[model samples]
Target chain A: MAPTFTTLGYLTAGLYTASLACYLRKLFAEGKWAGRAATLLLAAGLATHYFALLVRAYSIHSVPYQDLYGSTSLLAWFLVLTYLGLELIHGERAMGAFILPLVLLLLMLDFVATPHAAPAAPARGSVFALHVTSNILAYSAFTLSFVYSVVYLVQDRLLRGRRPIAIMWRLPPLEDLERMARSGVWVGLASLMVGIGFGMVVDRQVTGAMLQFDPKVVISFLILGFYVLYLTVSRSPAWRGARASVLCVVNYFAVVFSYTAVNLFFSRFHRFY
Target chain B: MSVYLLGVNHRTAGVALRERLHFSLEDGVRAGESLRRDGLVDEVVVLSTCNRSEVYSVVAQGAAQPEGGLERYFCSFHSIEPAQLNGCLYHRRDRDAVEHLYRVAAGLDSMLLGEAEILCQVRETYLAAQRAGLTGPILNRLFQAGLEVGKRVRAETRLGAQAMSVASAAMKLAEQIFGALKNNSAAVFGSGAMGAKAAQQLRSRGIGRLWVANRTPEHARELAARVGAQWAPWEKSAELLAQVDIVVTSVAGSEWSLTREALAAAMHARGNRRMFLIDLGVPRNIDPAAAGLYNVFLYGVDDLEEIVEQNRQARESEVPRAEAIVREHVEKFAAWQSGANAVAALADLRRKLRLQREIFTDAHREELAQFPAEERERILRLMDELVEDLLREPSERLMKDREVRERAVLLRDLFGLNAPDSSRRGGE
Candidate 1:
């Protein structure tokens, strides 16, 4: 018998957990090999995650973003991808200890929340795939922005409090955190705008509707607006550091609301799966 | 022979004593040469820096009262009386000396832990000794191993990662703000000593453009010329603020030299590009409220102190790991030293065996001359192999067993290997 998506998903979670342990070792102890080990494990976890998504897509004969479970899984995959990219670009491994735990949590949630069987109303077609993929990528970028914002705030607090802990020493510098946050916001805002555009196109194609009054659609646009405001205000001298980080955090909540509350409670016509 | 280190460092000696004992490069070379020339030490290297003065030497294994002689020689060389240097000196022999040298090279023994200058000092001292023809095989191996252990400790531990000084703390903080300072411009807000030091540190880290601003334009220009930076007029603070990526303020004053409003206006005009402000003043030259402004990272003396203290603590925590590396290398060097000691015994054994082989060949000279040339060559080859085979076990034992190595000199004496007439005895 072939290996199932659920098993591969569990394996991905295990790999991520191992990677997290290695990253923590690197952060706490002066282990020479721990960093390279952590990077390798994270790369392995990413590969397993991609394989799991592929398995799901093949088993269901549709894209992996056809349901809430698959979309969350894709978001987790993108988060790992973005983190790996940052790690490669920066040559810094300390952030992995903080990031891999979030990846593990999302993967575990995907496992617990996703159904064993495919949903009756599957989100099919290339337009739906493009739309969902873009949205998940946007959410993933937003999630990374949220993480960087939290790091920035924590570093700021540590600096201002005049209490430099060992963990604070291990963290990336405040400026690097801020730059990473800004990059995340830029990518997120662009992906979100493109996702909304594709969502509108899919909406018109499927239901002959121009502007649906769906809560998910409205909240996503609201989240977009929040980030657009963040991008503008963060450029000004007054709102750059703590204020900008707070704005990113606030926008992340809107993302959580759209991903969960709007999909579970309020969305009807916008529910593609 | 054994390696020995006799030294005084910042921890053991005050600045007065250290200054008295400090050796310049020329003094080090002269001292190393004189020590070796006087037959006091087989090999010697003298290392002297701001924080330390050390004599690393190789002496004959059983030399009587070597340490006392070395101590007296060190005192007299520096023209210091023994009474003045009695309590300030430390002596380590053999393994302890090796470990001390490794620790010094690795910066563990530095006043500022993990400072990198000592490694270069170690290299220079070794080179000076070598140029003076003072170092032999043992000192060469010890110094080379010391340098390697230093590099390994730095590469394998976090001891060398953080900044321990105020100037370095500023550079580290600037690095945090701007990942690389290679393309960044900085303006020093005063022509004070601290500002000049900070500017030098920044320039050392590859700051592209540097500006010195001061209340006295002439002083600013003088400092700029001294440090190879540009002098910006004192009244051009706002323009400098708008242009530079870093601003180091060391002006002595009670009032803030850089206010929040002024920085805010500058930030607005600069389109909120990221800027780092290092306030080295007591009352804080940059206003604390300026940190609230966008893209302005303001670190005062207290903030830098926190970072420096934390870094010092971190380096202290890494001492055990770095010491472990040093200890490992010390043990390896000790083993190599032992193996080196066994080399003489092995060579003596080979010489004795060759003497025995020649005696046997001479006794059978008539019988060997009766054989053909090919047969005679084969017999000589057999005798060479037999001698080698006969000594292989003893040679292996000499390298591995301490008891066997101790008995080697007895065996050499029994075989008359050290006698001047031993080779002629075989012919007689």
Candidate 2:
């Protein structure tokens, strides 16, 4: 059963990445053919990804939030969901043309690392479900913010260089990217807020505090602080674009360190494990 | 088929000559009627712009000798000496006419080569001709394709990206001096075309004040009124010259003017402040000898033209890409035209098929008269269904095919349904 899900996850990730790569090439050249193909590929990939997530849920039962493996899969699913939601609202396929591949990459890394389900993982409960879901969704928003920040960096560079209209025309305008980054930070904040709420609830229902004061937790708080500062400064207009992008980039690395790097090496307090 | 275009342009004729022969909107309306009236052309379209005025026409394949009445009509209508105008004029017929209009729209034929305004001017001229009821498919297709080509080039090339025109170059010079043109004052010499254009450019640059000085006071006043600039008489050109920091001159006047003596006094009064001077006059206004004076910098049209040429070359690099788009649109338009022509041919075929069906039904009427009524009705239904089935696909397919469009056009001519031009324009 693990093999079935593992294989589906691999196939879905490969297909999703291929779709994004193909669409990116088309958008840079002949927009019409690429536009049509990108939409179709995204829709198809989302369907397969949805199926794989459901299969993983059933195979493990209890919503697949066990340790590193289940949480990684859940985060990957959240990323895809957040992406599709934005795509539906904006009617812009370019975001998916950049985003889905990143999501797939994270999932693929999780697959290769192949973290086993922890024996100490909790049993089925609404509290655990709510805790993992909120945390992963917040991480998903961070993932998206990270993507736009990188795009903003490149676009801002080109705009300053006095590029011809066509070269940078493919990207969303600088103003649009800034707005998208702000929204991403807001959503990430909402996810962190809910995740923290669920953690307290879990602490109450279980014997003691299930979350340890691990280095990973501290780093996660610092990352959350950096972005909150970013958002607070963003209201002032002085802390936008490059300042915002830099903060988002740092936060993205913090997520990587907290979720994957610390889980793989440092300590045993990884809640997923 | 060869189509030639002939006209006097800004390069070929002086401003006085060009202004004298310039075609006003009303004159074009009248000229459109006269070109057809005098039987000099089988079809004619006139493209008259500020920089150029050309007549594009489709003449007879072979002709009997007749007076060149269109030429005579143009000269008499303008009340100009035929001898004086004839030397400046050029004539291009056949393919040249189409290519010239295309080049004009592409900005290749303008005084400022690769400028964008000519395309819009061509469209206006085409519409004016059309309104006068002087246009046919050949002219209509040519102008429409030319406009498309213009759009294609601008989209695919760096032509518009480069700042090279005299007006744009002057703007660039201002940008260099002021860093930003939020509040600069500039004096423009000679209220002629280029000077007026330069003053307008200065105003657009957000200049705080604009002054116009011309060889003629009324002309300067006219230009100043148009551009909202203060006018100075030509004799006081030196006295008022010290007031502004930037001076742009365009004197397509009869002789070299604005000597070293005139500018030296102005520079002395200006207290050695840096002033940019651009001289666009062909007869050499703001004499090169004036550059020795301090606080005075002067540049000529050739220097400006070189910059524009560089811009032109940059634009030329993008030509292939733009031409590719043009070719696509040209083919697309041709396909559309073919499809349109097919409608007529399909109509004709349908009419013939219906007539044949009627004749076949009539001939069988007698044979059916001897049969029982029920059998006859059944046979007639079969015949009608078969004819409908057979005609439907061929007619629709023929209407859809591109190759058949030309054949359809030929067929229309053969069938005597080549409706008159009036009905065509009125959408018959």
Q: For model 1, how does the per-residue alpha-carbon lDDT over B64-143 read when each residue is reduced to its tens digit?
A: 54678888988998898999987889999988999889999999988878988889999988998898898888888899
lDDT of 1 by residue, A70-136 (tens): 7777988999998899889989899888888878777667556736554564444677677778888
Cα lDDT tens digits, model 2, A41-116, are 7677767777877787777664666655567767877887787777677665666667876766667666476556
How far in Å is the alpha carbon of B170 misplaced in model 2?
A: 15
Give per-residue CA lDDT, model 2, range B1-428, as digits (tens).
Answer: 12446677887998888888888767876876887787666556767778877777754323332236666777887897788886788776544555566767877667765687888788888898877778776667777788877876665555545546768865764554343455567888887778878888888778888888877789989999998888877777777777777888887755747778877777667654546678888777787877655435566777666655655676667656655655566565556555555664556545655667778879888887998999988887787777678768866666566676556556555544443321132101
CAPRI class assigned to model 1: acceptable
Model 2 reproduces a share of the real contacts of 0.00
DockQ of each: 0.35, 0.03
User: Model 1, residue B172: displacement in angstroms?
Assistant: 3.1
Residue B51 alpha-carbon offset, candidate 2, angstroms: 3.7
For model 2, the superposed segments whose C-alpha errors exceed 4 Å read A2-52, A55-101, A107-122, A151-180, A231-245, A267-273, B1-21, B59-119, B144-316, B329-428
**Cα RMSD for predicted model 1:** 5.6
